[model samples]
Target: MPIKSIKVRLGLLSIIVLTGTMKTLGQANDTLLIRQLAPVTVSATRLEINEKRLPAALTVLGGGRIQIGQPQLSLFESLGGVAGLFAQNPDNFSQDLRISIRGFGARAAFGIRGIRLVIDGIPESTPDGQADVDNLDMGAMRRLEVMRGPSSGLFGNAAGGILNFQTENANEMSLLEGQVTVGSYGLRSYRFKTGVQKKKFQYVFIATRNQSEGYRALSHMESTILNLKLRYDFDSLTRISILANYGNSPVADDPGGLTLQQATENRRQAHPNNMRFLAGESVAQGRVGITFEKTMGKHLIFARAFGTKRDFANYLAFQAAGAGTINRTFAGASFQYQFSQKFDLIGYRFRLGMDVESQGDTRRRFDNLIGERGKLTFDQLESFKNIAAYVTQELTYQKVTMLVGLRSDAIRLHATDYFLTDGDQSGKRQFSRLNPSVGISLEASSKVNIYTNLGTSFETPTMSELSNNPTGTGGFNPDLNPQQAVNYEIGAKTYFSQRLRTDVALFDVEVKDELVPYQITGQAGRVFYRNAGRSRRQGVELSLNAVLAKGLTLFSNYTYSDFRYREYQTTTGKFDGNVLPGIPKHAAQAELRYFTPVGIFAIAQVRHASLLYADDANAVTANGYTVVNLRVGGQKTWGRMHIEPFIGVNNLLDAAYFQNVQINASANRYFEPSQGRFWFGGVKVGIK
Candidate 1:
């Protein structure tokens, strides 16, 4: 089916649903426990604010909603309800999870780019705009804020969006907890957590270990993580926080992608090349960060500093120099000041901030001799440094609020080659960018809000992307430059009553030098990057939450994307107007939650995605699929201890689906079969 037809059908369906549900607005509010709905609060824009008052699209998830009766494996498990966000490859730890917001991050070959990642008020992404989620601790997650759309004015490079995560702290509660989980395919997990408060000090700590035999051959993994959060309060107006995280993954084998026929024959089989070369990855990473904030009357100050180090090794399915290792160190700091004043009928607040960050990588490549490292082939040191300053103003008058932001960034990229056999390839690249954004929101009434915004963002190619020079063996790919975008968006939030809430957002974006990925023949697993001349991305997102009855709740969301290349040409082909690969045109999710006064809870979820193309040529398509999942759990208190047991069944209908698709893969190896009918059960013991 054509994308236009699908869009039309979805439009009709949305109208019908909205119209039918809104008819009941004339009735009285029937919320049983309105106070328990947990209103969403957003802080991704550098300040704590009400969602309805913000001029951007945002989604929030509480700790229980994200962790309860969940596998706690990857972000894919927690991000299902966020519209316009697509996540895949949950089981492929070697590549991390492929996450794309709107269409910005669709080009990432490994880890994440085109988006900003924040953890406990500190940046988690590297200076060059690359982030890996293997170190994120799902067990300690407290609140998650997903800010969708361009935000470069506030966050600088790769700010197509922001994902801010705040973990649990002892200030909220004090507890000691332990959990053990077992599942199919030789799965085992153990977690221990503790939180305590002493006088003005509070701390929360968590440790977890996970092991899996995987559903595919040669795809086993074992990893351990530790997280610590500490905070001190000097009265209510001043505070300091410390966050530390460490992760070690000794083994994470990769089951290389397969062709459709190969997957159809035996989905569990690993690629022959993968088995021959022992494809996989190992990562040992750690980071420490500190944040301080002070407020006095109408003035506020904030500061943050952090450092991270990573030792990584990867083995691919190809032979000649297909293995690589990177010893990376990254550090950054930021400071901000805010002033507020109130007039007779209007109020305004202003903020000024500055940031400095740097990243250095000692990278080396070697031949993959049947999973063993061979002779060294290439060696280089790559570094990226950044300095930025930004200013923002927020003004309010009656029921109207306006926001304006501007930022300037300076960046330097340098690399030094150690392998002289290919001649000296050292080089440096510099860039300076200025970005601006403005937005306004109107409280039409007590029950509705209308908002609109225009913003621009940029994403510089990562050090890894520049080092993989497609044309020759070199230190940096001088041709690979930064990608820029302009986004215009409008949205509305409505509350029929205490029982129903709905959000609708529409966005249009134009991109220049859009980054894209492709694989060269004979380099089956190695990915190369290139630029598309121009592209246009437009999307409609809708989400709703309803307290259907006393103990039942309904939540659902849908995303419709129309992304295509406006003018793009390459040696392989001319993709003047092709549907962007790796993202479905239509994606939707529906979840039902049933809770009783007794302490028992049940959840049923259904997820669907329309078929999407796998390559720029649009000659091959990945079939769409629907997956159903069910979870049930109950809580019981026993004196000073609370015991909770839960079980979950994923893909209840045993649907045939692809967990991941390697975009523009060589030899048409694009499919990674998803697991079928998986079951997991666990028990948690906690004391408060």
Candidate 2:
């Protein structure tokens, strides 16, 4: 069907549903009508402070809003339009999705290394503040909150910002929700969730099964997930909660980027035997947390502790006709305490907190090809700890508020490496840093605010960078040091008559001792981690939203980046200017939604990215591309049950492109190709 027709039909359906509901309410009791007409949100703030008064850059995605348009399956995809945020996934099954906030960690390959992800106050980042959201299940979430800029002082290690996924409170009677989807390339998925509440106890369970033939050959994947949460309230001021999650992913092939000739030949076909030569890894992760809260007259106290563990095995094919397997184990614990009061000196609200975290990682690599067989194996163990304390006081006077926070962090890093073949060992190294931040907000009116912030953050070297042994591909650099950054931002937000909203932000970041891989001669061209010269990145982000009429809404966001190196060390040991790699100059997204009378809705989305350099030397660049998507769905009531069905077309224009690339001196480049345009649709049901 045509996009315009879809929108027209959905608009009519929404009108019908609204009219019918109004008529039904007229016949019902006054109390019932009042209950049904109540405002939808009251939990925007965790505490008593008015949400409209908070001096922070925050965005909230409610569960109902998420279900209205039934946005993309990927949570990152759905977050595309948020200011200063960008999401890119090369393929559906790939664990490596690129996410950049305010130009931080834009070059990360696999997981987000600088951002912080939290769930119900449990820290999700590793000890050094690195986190990957590969295991997050968005279906069981009640809401998602994103706070940009350095939030490390509030939650340690959140240098880039913080993303919090809050699960539904199971204490609301009993409910069940599930969804089944089938689409192009034989794709299928099933997600089920159930929750029960009784007295002071509550429990929630979730399970998911997904499989797909994928858009490229040998790119098939199968995954299973399970989540369980339990909560108990001993008293009005005391509560305890526990959460556990497990996931398994088994799949084939790395749908690597292709050359120009290869892409022209066939975009859907994977390299020969890509599937047969593919073997996937299995990952399992879990966390446990405890919280305590107390109210003392005019003051409140909050404290929490948590521990997490993750295990994984990833296998890959090497160039020398050998397969390598990387086994990893990660574990960590964190604790924090906060004291706050609504009124203080100068009629200001003050909050002070301290956070401490420690984590350890162990990685083992096995190369079976060249061998002394098992004797040639390599192993490494690394550990890190972060300790930070901060105090934030928000002074409110009339319509103006000032938020000031100062934090200092002490980080300790240690590593040990062993080469099984020759009993060679590498020494350990340690590093530390301190960061601080300040912010301000001014309410120009009831619906408009202006804010600004300045902060400092740093990223320490990881175990992979400091301990990997040379195997013709890459070698470890034991002397690598930490990378440091300073960021400044100014932003404005406006809400027009509760029907339109807009936000804009400008940010600049400067860094020293940046980390980059350099190839060494005569050492089989092994890439080693080294500290690059100074660099700077600046960007502007704009977001706008409008509710057109009653059942139509539109949203859009755009970002422009200017990133370059002030001085970079080349192979000849000379300092030179070069542009940073993996950063696009421009990116934008727009989305439109329409509601119909038959409980149906339609949505259209478009995304565009400008050209980007693939190498630090600025010698290679990838062309830009644009993609479009369309989705249509509707909900119907069958007796006392509700059912919703949806169909979506991604990459409606069928544009072909590569998400990222690695350029080498030999003119041999490696690319991670993006999937072509595809179609998907699904059905969802709920019970209350």
Predicted model with the maximum TM-score? 1
What lDDT does the true structure give each of the candidates?
0.87, 0.63
lDDT string for model 1 (1-688, tens) is: 3434433443453334333312221111234435335456677988666788899998888786788788787788878889989988888888888888998788888888888999988898887888899988788898889999989999999998899998988755438899887776777889999999989999999999999988999889999999988899999999999999999999999998999999999999999999999999999999999999999999999999999999999999988888999999999999999999999999899999999999999999999998888998889999999999999999999999998999999999999999889799999999999999999999999999999999999999999999988875878897888999999999998887777888999999999999999998878788899989999999999999888886788889999999999999999899988999999999999998886555566899999999999999899889999999998776656556666667778899999889898999999899999988888777777887
Candidate 1 has a TM-score of 0.95
TM-scores for all candidates: the values are: 0.95, 0.86
CA RMSD per model (angstroms): 7.9, 5.4
Quick one: best lDDT, which candidate? 1
Reference-based TM-score, model 2: 0.86
